[model samples]
Target chain A: MSECTKLEMKDLLPDLARGALAGPALAALEDHLATCASCRAELELVRAAQTVLGATPSVDTARIAAAVGRSSSIRRDATVAVAQARRRRAWSVAAPSRRVWLAAASIVAAVGVSVIASNTTRSPVEPGPAPTVAQVEQPSTPGPTTPEPTRPAAPRSTGRAELVMAGGVSDLADADLESLLRVLDDVDTELDVEPAVLLPVLEGDV
Target chain B: MTEPTRDGEPSDAALIARWRGGDERAATILVERHAPAVSRFVASMGERGEVEEVVQDTFVRAFGSLDRFREASSLRTWLFSIARNLCRDRARANRRAPTVVAIDETHLLSSSDPLSAAVATETESRLRAAMERLTETQRAVFTLRVAEGWSYREIADVVETTEGAARVHYHNAVRLVKEYLDE
Candidate 1:
């Protein structure tokens, strides 16, 4: 391809087309182009390529600019959104929803109402402490469940009747009357007989 | 040979500095100045139908790693280097043979010289076809050197070769184009 002796001069063809060659370089390229048809034709080819580039479709600068800018904003927005979501999660964990609080409150109120209703409606079934015979002796009203307790047919002559003579104490439950009479009678009879004999029976029950 | 625009606008370094300082308009100006040249280089490298996308990706990657870029270097050549890498990566991803896409005149968007557009489209197509016949490296060297008016050093940097290799590629490319056109 070096028909003209100066093949190295062909390298400057690009600069010549771009008008970058100046002073000595420009002078030299011109001096060599005077006799170099190979270099001249190559220069034409380079110029033609430059022309094609100029005429080719160009990308829309505005679109690319907007894309770059959007990346920054998108990152910022994503960060903010994540932070807000975390805050909401923490708040929900710290304080439960109002609906949950209301449901809990309703359960407590229902339990309290049931407890008070049971305490008032039923006899105070808290295990009645062992009543002293004196507390049970008051011939008070009939028992709640029986309405009228038949006089416990055991000894009316026994000193247990004297238990009734003993002053009536307050807050005596009529429910304990029958048992109280029978137990007091038995104890009186036992004391009269022998504590030695009752001990064996009580020990057997234990 | 690299310089500011004729109207005394800001240089690439100045724009990059402003962008780093959060003045976003500077980024727009930089894209406007360099995207056309990057597009031309990408198209000349046998990338068709995706020229704009490749150009866009090059800028995005360049700006993404702007902190690492040396401001003193030529941004245009740097963009060409990035575009070259992107085209290579895409070729590998596709795992298909490279095909030369013919340049369509109807796709022409803007031109500096209306007279050149009117008179030179057919010759331009012929030249583009001849360019497409060269090896990928030769076409890239030729494009950066002749079309973008880049020096052999800048071309070597883009194509990842020595300046001597770039010069040889350019010479071979010219000879091949001449042969093709003569046919």
Candidate 2:
């Protein structure tokens, strides 16, 4: 029989010691070990080390359980603290939407323009020939004053048309100015009515 | 709390699921079942006096990150991987602090059974010193193989190496340890 190489025997030594080798492999390994002094010695050393290492003292399970209990309590408290902090952060930042901001900006701009228009109209100027009371009272009707169009129409009177042209608000009709102010009033009312709903929607986004 | 079945205890996955569902006892059961093995693993890696603390930390960290555990590996293997990392961290921290000394047989001989303890302590001291001579990977592979009776595949998983490399490390470790003990 051929002598077993140390490398081949090294691979088999642990299995041999543990009785894992079976059938012809076991018989072959045993035959090889019978003549191999170094492999025998190496196997002995491995077994000895395994035995020594396996003798490590058992741990105290009760103490570990107690420690785990303490750790879990601490972790629970930390988690609760973190969740509370997140909630506080959510409440502190009322992030309005781009649409809401746009609406708000439109209202502010409209109010500023209205204020300027009213101020300019009221301003003292060199007295020109004042309009006759009859002209003011007659109500310069341009077309049949049909019930207000669902959408804004071009300014009908020359005076109104001049105001639109000078203001550069091509889309504005005298009647639609009242509608824009009403829409702004509705938006302001909605904001005041539902402050609570705003927070959950923003938090969901977060 | 679900009562443990009479035929056998629940699996680790079941326990983890229970723990996630708010049954604290499941967490306790998991700790009790796996803590000793983790402690032994840490101790084998040359950690002493604080094996319990490390094992506790491992469980706490494991539970905290339970959602990340895919259950692809056995829970015990996962715990060993965590314990190995904790050992590495502790070793680094201890290196930074000059005051801490490594524990040895003297620390282990505190048992009431003096005669057997003496014999065991001597053997353990020689083995530990021999292990100390090995590189970290060699020591880990050897200990996991011999001390923990792990297969090369399992050792590879814990040490983050291929099975062939783990076997190579184990053999090299065995030779070095044998030479050290022989001397």
Candidate 3:
């Protein structure tokens, strides 16, 4: 009988122990093992090692379950917290920009109102006291005898109407309205009377 | 054969699907089913005394990143891989390398006769000590092979090596273990 190589025998040992080899290969390996003392000892050693290692201690299933339960709960809570924080951060970022745009729109409205008031009263450009709400709201009919101000042609309304439509003016506060009118009064020296007068005419036509 | 589940339970994939769909019970089922195996693998890899903590950490990380899991490998293999990495990280954090210490052998040995039990216990202790003498990779390979009965290919995949390298490691490990026992 031809002896199997030690390498071949060693390779077969694991499969042999697992009862994997069959037919001629099994017969040859067993014949070789029966004759080889070293291989037999090696096989025994392998079996012993497997047996010893296979005795790994079993873990307590209940303890593991409880631990996992706690961990999952904590993780879920953490995820929710992170999501809420992100939403808050988004709102925090968005809130200020909305206020800024609204304030800008109010200032533009105040500028238009100041130009109309100046044209109607023909007031000299002085740092006069702020107009009362009743005076600002009072309509000035272009009287039959009063000369219409020599106003320049009006510029296109820079989409202020659209902005007003998108963001309603009712959200503006009283303090913001006062501050806007004050800023427009400060810029009255640079104001052209023609476009200011034509603005009302444009509105009347609309 | 269909892999058996405890008491006709659903498979891991099914459980994962249910959990994703907001079924809390499925999450509990998955945890109970795989946690022990993860603990055993962690302990076998020489992570003592906090096996449960490490296992919990593994599950937490696994659940957190469940969307990233492509399911190309079996869930068992994936969990083992995660457990192994956690053990490595723990070892690094502790600033201590993995050294093979004598594993508790009493759990593995059982005999009605006291003398046989004592003998079995001693033998298992000696074998475990010899196992400790192996490098981490060799120990991991050997345990996965002998204890878990994983295929060489599967061991290679978990260990991130070629099958040839895993075979070499296993054979070298077996030889060293045998020589230690002989001595």
Tell me, by DockQ, which candidate is best.
2
DockQ for every model, please: 0.21, 0.34, 0.31
Q: Which of candidates 1 and 2 reaches a greater lDDT?
A: 1
Candidate 2 segments exceeding 4 Å error: A1-9, A12-29, A73-103, A106-206, B1-7, B99-103, B106-124
Model 3, A1-206: lDDT tens digits are 23335776676676677666799989998998888977887777667676765554556656655665665565566566555655665665565565577566766665566554444444455443434223334335243432234222444233444334323343345676677567555444222222233332222121
TM-scores for candidates 1 onward, in order: 0.60, 0.65, 0.64
Per-candidate RMSD vs. true structure?
Answer: 25.1, 11.1, 14.6
DockQ of 3: 0.31
| Interface Cα RMSD, each model | 15.4, 5.3, 11.3
Q: Point out the worst 10-residue segment of candidate 1 chain A by lDDT.
A: A197-206
Error of 2 at B56 (Å): 1.6
lDDT of 2 by residue, B67-120 (tens): 677677777777788889889988888778845546544345455789887776
Predicted candidate 1 versus true structure: per-residue lDDT over B1-183, tens digit per residue: 364464778888888889878888998999888888788778777777888888888887777667668766778777888889898888776657656655666654346888876556667677777887888898888888787777788888888889899988988888898889889
Worst 10 residues of 3 chain A by lDDT: A197-206
What tens-digit string does per-residue lDDT give for candidate 2 at A16-49?
Answer: 6666679888888788788887778877766766
- Where model 3 places Cα greater than 4 Å from the true spot, the runs are A1-32, A93-206, B1-9, B93-102, B112-119
Give per-candidate clash totals: 0, 0, 3
